[model samples]
Target: MADIEERRPRNKATTFLLVLAAAAFVVASALRLLGIDGTRHMVATTALVPYFTAAGVLLGAIALLARRWFVGTVTLLVALVLVAAVAPRAFPDARPIGVGQEVRVMAANLLVGKADAEVLVAAVRDHAVDVLALQELSPAMVVDLERAGLDEVLPHRVFLAEPGASGSGIASRYPLTARDLAGPSTLRQAGALVALPGADLEVVSVHPLPPVTPDGPEPWQRDMAGLPRPDLNGPYRVLAGDFNATLDHVGLRRLLNHGYVDAADQVGAGLDPTWPADAVWPPPVVIDHILVDDRCPVDTFQVVDIPGSDHRAIVSQFVVPAR
Candidate 1:
């Protein structure tokens, strides 16, 4: 009787922890599903839905192993909700193989004009990138990039090189013509039409305002909503750069709904993180992306490390269907 009583407190404590874990899982799942982006911090938290969901699954499994049937079952159910939410992105539709010309694209944000020009140029050269989308470009960085022989690799270019986060540019091996896109007035997002041999592709370098302050959330939402949507029947499209939103963000998800798919997600690499490259721990979220239309089939997607930038670069090989 004495031994049983001594174990009772431990059992109660365990039960309490299990219940707490389950409740946290339920709350996180609900917040993500609900797509609440009303506040700045909430929007930032939304970016971590996948991580939260993953934690829930781990805790639920632990509960199950401990034979806490009721707690285990409830936690598992909550965890399952997260699994369902991420299933579409984690396992996207299979892409068609051997149907189009290959186009390799690389995108990177320069950390408000702080990325190394030589490192950026090296990435383009080493990766043999056909198109390079850069955000947070500055006049000085543009000069440095040009001096680093970026022009030799990607001769055709369109750029709006400014200071701070409101700068973007595109460099392509093929001819490029500037195209206007609707977005926030303050952000320096730019679009260009790349005239390929047999097909035309619209590539946009986007850098939405980060949601970090009390007034940042609304503009961030507006910036995402303002991005141009691809015409499914028209030219092939690719939107790349630091979007300041993750797959978990409803705004980015809504953008994807407009006949576009994330290149990394399509290739089963959706869980890779791309921001805070210099973090002490591994980056926790993927804010950079290569979003392509269905007309373009993704072959492979990779996240490349760039020195002096807070965000890593995304390199994707896309097969644009021949017109």
Candidate 2:
């Protein structure tokens, strides 16, 4: 009788813990699904949806092993919800045949002029990147890139190369005409029109503030919302750089809602992380991206490592229809 009572308390304690864990997961899952991140912490928290999905699976298994059938069922349901949200990213989608200009675009954050200039230039050369969008660019980095033969690979340029992280720029194998895409952003988010063979591509180097800033998520949200929307009648557009927000964020999602598709997501490589490259803590997350007009077909997507930078560069190839 004594042993039975002792075990009963222990069983109840286990059940309580499991239920608490399940509730936390359910809340997180719901936040991601509904896209309700009002606070900076919530914004940062929701970026871990992929990790949440994995954790939910483990949690469900633990509940089942504990013989907590009800908890197990609920946790598994939450896991299912997460899986439904995340699984599609792992499989490629049927892309339309692109019989137009083939553009190899790449975006990299220079970590405020600290990323390896030679390595970045080499990536541009090896990948044959037609357009390179850069964030956190500096005038010194510009000189370094040119010294490293970036101008030879992608000669045309439009840059707002300040000394700090506020700077941004674009370089292209084709001619580039600068376009102002100024918004409520602390960074100089620059844009240019790439004069391609048969079509012009409006490319923007995007870098909205991180939600984890001292000012909070409002500025970040505003910047994201203020980003240029896709116009079907206009030239095909591509926005690339350190977005600082993932597809899971409502800000990014809202921007995507306007006829834009993530290049990585289009080809099932969406879950690949592009931030915190050199660090062990905070794991890694996909904060950088290449968003294009939905009409464009993405061919190949790759995330390349840049030495001395905390961000990995995303290189993508796609075709824009010639009008």
Whole-model Cα lDDT of every candidate shown, in order:
0.85, 0.91
Candidate 2 per-residue lDDT over residues 48-74, each given as its tens digit: 999999999999999999999988989
By summed lDDT, the worst window of 10 consecutive residues in model 2 runs over: 179-188
TM-score of every model versus the real structure? 0.92, 0.97
**Deviation in Å, model 1, residue 197 alpha carbon:** 1.0
Q: Which candidate is the best by lDDT?
A: 2
**Candidate 2 global lDDT:** 0.91
After the best TM-score superposition of candidate 1, give how far the Cα of residue 314 lies from its true spot, in angstroms: 1.0
Off by over 4 Å in 2: none
Task: Tally clashes: model 1.
Answer: 0
Candidate 1 regions with alpha-carbon error over 4 angstroms = 1-7, 65-67, 87-93, 280-283
Candidate 1 lDDT at 153 equals 100
Task: Output the worst ten-in-a-row residue range by lDDT, candidate 1.
Answer: 275-284
